[model samples]
Target chain A: MTLEILAFALAALLMLGGAAVVALTKDLMRLVVGLGAFLLGVAGMFLYYGHAFLATAQVFVYVGGVLVLVVFAVMVVHRANGGRPLVTSQHDIGAAAVAFGVSGMLVMSLRESVGGWLPESGTSGSSIAQELLGGHLVAFELLGVLLLVALVAVLLIVGPGERR
Target chain B: MTLLWGFLWGVAAVATIAGGAILGVWWERKVSARIQMRYGPQQIGPFGSLQMIADVPKLLFKEDIVPALADKAIFKYAPLFVFGPVAVSMVVIPFTAGWAPLNTSVGVLFFLAVPSIEVIAILLSAWASHNTLSTLGGLRATAQMISYEVPRSLAVLAIVLLAGSLRPLDVVAAWRWWWMPLTFVAFVIYFVASIAEMNRGPFDIPEAESELVAGYFADYSGMRWASFMMAEYGAMIAASLFGAALFFGGGWPFGGALGVITLIVKAILIMTAIMWVKWTFPRLRQDQLMSFCWKALTPLALVQLVVVGVVLVWL
Candidate 1:
């Protein structure tokens, strides 16, 4: 129990630290890093609460997918900027006040539904498999079909490539 | 106590990876040499088994070079990031009868999901190099891995489907001899995609040394550079062992003490096949690589998945 609490504290620290980096730093790359840390913290919380599937999905999608693309965008911009990425520190009181206000409002809004979002216990790997492969079987498997359709759609729309 | 145990197992897992990489490197040299009509490394410890002893010291003593323009922190730390995920994944391999080193409930899923994080580390290593070619290599690697991941996961999902559980122990426990033929196509797809995931040829466009000057780790030297190679060999080992356990039914036929030997032998056989395929195939063109993945492999993997699902339902 104490270990769990300590872990929870660590997750909280990561979330707070990440938010600070995102809010205070204007460097696009650092922002991406900060966002990654924040998303990881969120995933950690989900794992702590036994939302294993959600946590993994969060890491897979947000950290793996969204953040990577954002980093690429930033890198491309860096090349455009003649090497150095545009970065600054947002130390002004007005910006801080606005950021804090918006954050607090968001937290207040989420307070009621947070309990509903948190699962009673952490999900074990087996139960997630059963849930995904059983209850949501058709929907889940059809995702492959969805990907295949898109692949075919692109080929058809593009038509056979021009003879080399 | 639980944390202590986890730490100890983690150490054992890392040790297994290092040991496997050592053996794998020697085996790969010998096999590739035979394929080419060469003796390979004949000196030092009977057919070059101890070649790594010499290589390791040389690599370690070499001056570590960090590019002046490199992101020092990311550059220094990223190899661990690259190597660590594969090492952790090793912990979940269902070695022997109904046991894994870590034996987590979600072992199989954890094994598959965790390694995807390596892409981020690859990107960081490339970016930290501050070299255009390295960056380009990183991009190619990122795209290849992300693309191939689709079919790979679908292929492994077939095993989860068969076992009706995510636990590696359960997967092996539920395995049957007939599964070898039944999921054969899935096994092949899994094997091929695993090679791509490891960035071996014909999918090695990321580090196509002829073009990228060794790609993302180009700027790294000495021990840091060695880790990347170790990670690749380690990944090959882990994938082979996992695949052997899932599709080959691990060691059930041999049973008892020999079960462990059987599983290791199966994995080594798979690893040899991987090396054979690597040596034989020419690297694919970038466009060809992407096309082959999307048009050919992905569809075939899906068909395999459907076939497995149907047969499973019938049974």
Candidate 2:
């Protein structure tokens, strides 16, 4: 049990560390690498949660899909420019401060409201599916619609574009 | 006893890697050859069963070269990144009852998650090579993987819904009695998506040999190229294993040790089917590939998910 806890902690740390690297990296490609690491760590967390399906989905979708898109976009945009600039203006101090403040407040509020209580529901994959399809059917259906809209939007954005 | 189990697991994994690669390569050649109306590797050994063995030593002894301008560090490690996770994923894949080396509740997830690392390895290899075509191939691969991933996830989610557990064993057990129509659809989606993800024929735009030389590995030669091939074949086998485990009641029709053999047989059958598709179908244009996933497969998967949800509730 202690070992499991340690493993979870390690996985969480790895995820946060990767996210920090992604947030802090100056190099655009390096940022993508960090994001990949972050996703991998999240996959580890999913494994810890005994949700291999979710973990695998996270790997297949976020790490494989999102990271690849980001890399391709970077390449495309970079090619449009003569070459990628070595440095950009480090002018996001204000934005960072606002983000930090918002995060702090959100964390504080969560702590105050929930008081460190974690749900102990032994909701297996089947039970979760039942809940999603039965009681939360409307919300589930709404997510499906949202996904469809997103798919169409992606097509419109990416398809039939002029080759640069 | 723990050490003995670990040793046995290690041996099983090594055998799986070597044997899977050998069989997958042979099957791919034979299927492609048959599709092209030619005999493949018939001269070497019985039905060319030993051809892959002959190629192994040649590949191993070949020169490992690196371009002068390439990032030496990443170039050296990229193949490991590609190959390691693939081997590791087999740990969680149960061939027969109580036979998995690293059986966990999240077995299916572990199996699925490991292959994404291959994308990173490819991207890094492309960048490290510092070649124009290689870079473009890497970029294209990334785009392809990302675009197809949505439908793939939805399909897997549908399976998870049906199985009610994340373990691959559980998935097989769930399908033992009766195959759900929704699960069957999910299986088809999963199979197609897995093929695309592996960059097989039709979806082999990233590595289109005639057009892009060798795609992302255009600059790679000798052992580096071999590593990439090994990874691709490993992934093919892994995907086949996953498909067999989930959709076909893995290791069924055979009991105990024979079940493991049966599981391999199932995977090989799937691999051959994929190869047949590869050799028969012409490659899809890049835009067509994207549209197929986003426009066609994605919606079908979504509808399947809804239908499954409804069926689960009412039935």
Candidate 3:
């Protein structure tokens, strides 16, 4: 029990530290890498909670899918030297204010939720699948439609080119 | 006690990764050399078997170079991100029945999920190096991985649907001899998607030498660079092991030590096939690579998944 707590605390520290770096860094590369670290740290926390499937999915979807998309977008718009920071000091105060407000609300909500937390762990992927297919089928179909719409929109925006 | 055992298993995993990487590298050189009609590493050891092993010391002893304008910390840790997940993925891979280090029920999903993390490492190293070519390479890699990952997962979805379980052993168990003919398409799609995902030959446009000039790792040197190479071979081994276990009947008709050997032999056979494809296929143009993945493989995998799901449900 003590060990799990220690592990969780360490993961939380890593997550927060990485998030701080992502928020504060001047370099665009560091900002993205910090975000990757932040995502991995979150994944670690999921693992600590015995959600191996979720942890792996977190790494797969965010670190692999979302972060790569973020980097690719940066590559297209950013300079060759990568010299500029994506976020500048002019935005810092406004960003900090928003961050604080969000954090305060989140903390309060978290406190409210903590009292009802379950002690046991481990949710198999099959159970999640069953819930998604059986109970949340409508939501699942909606998500699929949403993703399909997004794909079509992107295709319409980019348009097709000459095929080989 | 669990913590101590986990630590020990982690150490063992790392050692296996390092050793397996060396062996894979050597095997690649030999196979490619044979295909190209030349002797590879003949002087280093018997049949040049120790060449990659010898290169380890050389890579370690070489001076590590960081680009002058590079983000030093990001550059340093980038390779770790590339290799670490590949190493950690060893835990969920089943050698035989009840033999995996961590026998989580989500083993199939976990296997598919882990190696995709390498793109982050590539993107980081490329961006942090402050080189235009490196950045381009990184962008190419990111695009390639993102495009192929969808189909890769979709292809695996067929297997998961057929097996009705996410565990590696269960997926293997669902396969009978007759089922092989039907599932072969998914296997091929998975194999090709994996090749693209691993950024190997034909899809090796990310680091096309004539174009990008070593691509993302152009500025990386010494042990830092070695880490990236190790990561690539590690991914190869993992992918091959996965293909073997999932598609090639896994370690069956045996148990215990013999089962482990059978599993490895199956994996190596798949590795040989990968090597053959690597040596034979010419590199695809960047645009062609993207189109082939998005326009061809993705739709095929989606169709395969649907067919499998339908068949599983109805017949």
Clashing pairs in 3: none
Q: Give the per-residue lDDT of model 2 (tens digit) for A1-164.
A: 77678778878887898889877767666667678778888888977877655666688678766776676666666652243323364668986888899999999999888754433442355555666787789989999999999999988898878446
User: What would the per-residue lDDT of candidate 3 be over residues B150-177, giving only the tens digit for each residue?
Assistant: 8888888887787788887777766566
- Model 1 — TM-score against the truth? 0.88
Query: Which of the numbered candidates is closest to the native, going by highest TM-score?
Result: 3
Which pairs of residues collide in candidate 1?
A: A50-A122, A50-A123
Q: Kindly list the per-residue Cα lDDT of model 3 for residues A28-89, writing each as its tens digit.
A: 76788778779989999989877888888898899888888887888788887648556668
Q: Rank the candidates by lDDT, best first.
A: 1, 3, 2
Stretches > 4 Å off in candidate 1: A88-98, A114-164
- Measured against the native two-chain assembly using Cα atoms, what DockQ does each of the candidate structures obtain, in the order listed? 0.33, 0.35, 0.67
Q: Over the stretch B97-165, how does candidate 2's per-residue lDDT look in tens digits? A: 656678677676667666777887888777777677888888788778766767887888777777777
Best by lDDT: 1
Lowest summed lDDT across 10 adjacent residues in model 1 chain B is found at B98-107
Error of 3 at A147 (Å): 4.7
